[model samples]
Target: MGLRSHEQLVVCVGVMFLLTVCITAFFFLPSGGADLYFREENTVHVRDAFIREELRRKEQEELRKKAEEAIPIPIPKPEIGAADDAEGRRIFVKQMIKFSWDGYRKYAWGENELRPNSRSGHSSSIFGYGKTGATIIDAIDTLYIVGLKEEYKDAREWISHFDFKEAAKGDLSVFETNIRFTGGLLSAYALTGDKMFLKKAEEVATVLLPAFDTPSGIPYSLIDLQTGRAKTYSWASGKAILSEYGSIQLEFDYLSNLTGNPVFAEKANKIRDVLTSMEKPEGLYPIYISMDNPPRWGQHLFSMGAMADSWYEYLLKQWISTGKTDDRTKREYEEAMFAMEKRMLFKSEPSNLWYFAKMNGNRVEHSFEHLACFCGGMAVLHSMNEPNRTISEHYLTLGKEIGHTCHESYSRSTTGIGPESFQFTSSIEAKTERRQDSYYILRPEVVETWFYLWRATKDEKYRQWAWDHVQNLEKYAKVNFFEPFLNSSPSYFQGAAGYSGIRNVYDSAPEQDDVQQSFLFAELFKYLYLIFSDDSVLSLDQWVFNTEAHPFRIRRP
Candidate 1:
């Protein structure tokens, strides 16, 4: 039969067909999921049909392999092992808000943060923003997020008492103001339809306009809110953080659109115009850009970490916030995402753990940050805006996988909290190997990603995983103060478990970091609450959040 004679084989096969059937079944369908041929059919016509089906089967197998490689996570029907996680999440969110709100009122009312350990307030000089009383502004929407309407109303009124003209007498961060204050105000207005919040936005924007007086149209980082002068010690000192300049566009553009003034949009869009003219290697912008010299990139650091994370974020968000009308901004985002794909993605060679790597220049630094986890959520949001369905699904799968890696970062830790910074190595030096930054400042990026993934996939597994994060905070970082419990002070001792920051995640029983970032309320818990709630809350297509977790509708420009 191995004679170079197809005619002889075909003639013999038609006469005695069993031999042909056996050969075709063994060769064509050995490793397949389903059988391709029957026991009876073995003539040339049947042989031709089997060959065609087998070729089609092989082609499908190859395509499946490629798709699996592209998106490694399996999107099975979510495991529904527990029903109580949702109820627990709802209870947990409200309880934490009440506890934190009461703590702030007792100790640091009208101040930036509650020092849970010390029960006092001070200039959060560590952040260099110098603005006092930011937590209240940031926390207002979190109360609303959890549907604590009575608390939200009280907090809203409490905030109305602060006079911006006098409150302006501090060193202010352009990024923090645009996010926690301006973004917060706009979100409050959107949620409540209150004119007072809108009024506050106008007042704050009036004072904030001066920060853009720089020649490059990029705003300086710090300004004297009272004096209308930029601080020399901040970005005005011939340096600018890349994230600070790039992150403000969403809030500013929203302000411009709602109010019908060109100035807000004009100032913010110039940063994009400047970005358009510059040279970005591999389509990547460095961590610092000179606000003074728009052409000269500042630091050599290239990362999706803290200093550069939101630079990529606002690019994608700008197009969405503008009702998808801005193709120029959309193109800019697409180019940056191409760079993100090329430069930042990595898998740990030793452990098989997927993680995004930080970069110095063109080299992989093998570093990771809790802050960079926001990229997972941002990736999902980016995919939603994409026109190509196949690519969108693939990116969504990538986001789910990345979120899994971030969850692993927490679960692998003894303290059950993620590190502020960490790195992977190409060594099998230990079975579960990585180095970590010692502290956990209660950042929300990882949990925020969990929310986005769960919301997109409707996977209860993501919700369960986020509840693990909440329990970690409950076990390790929670703190409380009651007036009756510790009567040693000028004021009080009232004990309640408020969500607070930790000094270090590496310590099994670490000391509290004491300074709860405003974003804990603005971002972390809000996302957690939304993930566990019903599907209708902040639907993905209807709303998009600014960098600080302030939600905005996809408004027509």
Candidate 2:
């Protein structure tokens, strides 16, 4: 009662601080026997709560890791002033893509391909009998890479509404659909970080899954998307084509990685198990394989061409794509390559050019398809990743020799475009024997090899070779279609014509095939553009290209 007001306030603050300390000690710093007894009684509940909290934290962390894994590493855009004429050449290729895309948009719009000469749209059997816009799907990733924002945006809008369930009627080639549609969408998602493309890719893949429901898990060549029923090509005699089934793994495995779904990879891995278990004669797989529980080689013929090329291509690429953790793929790829070097590799007389010949039984056929020209690029790419210096050197040499031989196929031709197939007999070197083999379908293998070689070696000649192809394409393959519909476009676009295949590369003035294939935009122009781009853009270390030239990001462990 006699104390001043200030002294009374200080006394109250001291009492409150002491009370708070006493309360904290009572809950958290037990010391008395009675307090220890109460703590023991509740220990079980406390431990359980702590464990639950830890588990929840771990679950969150795992989800975070998966989300990070799904995020695509952005591809580097081409620098403005790259060395030498690289920027200029890249621009030329970009212009070519624009020209081709414009023609497709104007004529085909939503069709599979453009008949440039006829100025109309056409659908191929590979895509079934409907307007699935195969060209548009194939060109989306290309458009994004070349900075064609408006075109890419338009394609994305169409893709947003594309229904695989109602894509087409009758049989669709599982291989072609996987490569063009699934692969294209996957690559677009990888480059653009767009979930729309990924969703569409999963839809197509799910529809195609029934194709793998075979006794051997080897996919059928064709599947009716509507019916979900699959069957081998009638011409295949109820057997699966090696390339068709084998080439799909890259797409499916990649889909699984992006979606965190293991089923897609399991189905694809089953195909690998079947092929790996089957006995390959002379360590070489046949073009046709049985679809039984234990599959058998359907033919004695062996080739690195049309029916079998991409099988080997995928084997090597799958290993690389999976962050090189797939030792089985690497082993199989190495074994196949060793066998190919021993049995298929040959040198033509006089000209002394290297090539891979086909094998029928024990007989070696001195024949090569333009389709096999991709082997050179495959070799070079494999060499870069190889651990053995000697093997790597050998592959590099082999790649260059093969590249030169393929270039000869074009240089020897009158129109500077290679034919479908060629021979390497005593009298002939890179010359076609059959009239049917002389036609050029605007194939990209030769230029694809040049692009790979250039990237691997930085040799100027590869650039020159690719440039030569561009010049020839501009000269002979260009289709100048003038119509009132195109008048609204710029003056430069009027001169920028759509490209078509030639009836004969041997013709000084080759007749146009009238059709512009989807691959012209997908593989050909894309490869040409990449050839002139900086190495940092889509560097080989960070990505793996599927057989269709659609690049997938490397999935790291």
Candidate 3:
């Protein structure tokens, strides 16, 4: 019995040992295996999260570096008057810009232009086919300068998705696209330090490069942005206009500098070399030049009004753009000014109003275009660089006289707005007799001159003249909400009203031309803002304005 009891106790002990082993296996071994698997999986996820964070941090640092590099040199703000009305004037201009932009946003939106009278959008041939957002591109810098943050942000977003390749249709004007798009983009980059604008500018400029594929390296007036095939306008007699090709250097050169690309500078410099090498008739460039292997002048026409205006303006501006180091450009500009003073510059009979007349051979046309009014500002700008006090004083005098004459053209008009073209005849001082020359297309040249004159001389008259022009524009050019019935149904026009061109600046009740040019935003409003603000806003010392009034940073030596 004792033996059986001992065997029973041993069996019980064995069973207890087996149960303990089972519990250890179930609770410890499987849990260890599961922990190993989960630890490995968690490590991978943590590594992935860490890598993503590192990449995001690196991207942010790169953007910060780019912004630092793009910041403009510190400019000392000028001391304004103690009780200056400049702020008041600036506010007025800002409101005008906002008004114009609001109208465009509501009615035109992505289209090239605004039909203010009709309260609709109109795409012109110059902006290619369809809606290219030309107005938006042109006004982006203006919006930024005026501190319209919301409007500026909207513009930037639209530009981020803008596809130039798709925007291309039919033929695009190389000059127009360069000045309004590429120039505008470059200006925005200079102002905002945003790389998106630089990218877009380079893209558009690449598309435009093929236009300079001619034997003489002279760019065609018009180019198919898609096909890259280029040709001159039929009206130009298969020759490129001087203003079209010559005016592109500022944009291209600025682009080349920004991107560190030699190609753009080479193309632009080639145009300059050709112009500098060519023999000028009476030291004045013709309005048209052929695109031949050895280019030839097209016509004997020389005018500072239309075909030949910006070319001369660019010569001086290019010098300033390159840190005033391009002595050749300066010399060429001086020679042209001397020749113009001798040949084209004249004074009207009784009023003695100074004007730059058109020259066909040796004969003077005795006519002035509102477009040529920009020459007054050009003269004022150049006078600052002239070393000779006598010549500088003469340029200043000429600039003031030109500014005065342009103001007279506006003040003498029945509507207090200048005509497209006016004559300096024995009887007529600044009146357009021809019906074709009677319209005013919201031009900024006259006021552009006033802005320059105001900056240079600080004469209250210049500001007053600009204010007068603005008042006239508001009274006559601003499209009235009641005018929707002039073209479309009132229900179709539900947005803000925009400024329209007057059929006749001389007519008290002139017909609306129903078009708002992109330049109204790019040039007129911009100039108005600059003239009213302190010179430090976009000081002439640190910046050079393109022909389109888009300011670019001057390369400092």
lDDT of 1 by residue, 251-351 (tens): 88888878888888898888888989998877888877675654588656788887888988888888888888888888888788777777777777655
Write down the worst ten-residue block by lDDT for model 1.
Answer: 72-81
Ranking by lDDT: 2, 3, 1
Instruction: Mark the 10 consecutive residues where model 2 has the least summed lDDT.
Output: 484-493
For each candidate in turn, give its C-alpha RMSD to the true structure in angstroms: 30.2, 27.0, 19.2
What tens digits encode model 2's per-residue C-alpha lDDT throughout 44-91? 789999999999778666655555466442333243333248778788
TM-score of 1: 0.80
Please give the lDDT score for candidate 1. 0.75
TM-score of each: 0.80, 0.83, 0.83
Best of the two (1, 2) by lDDT:
2
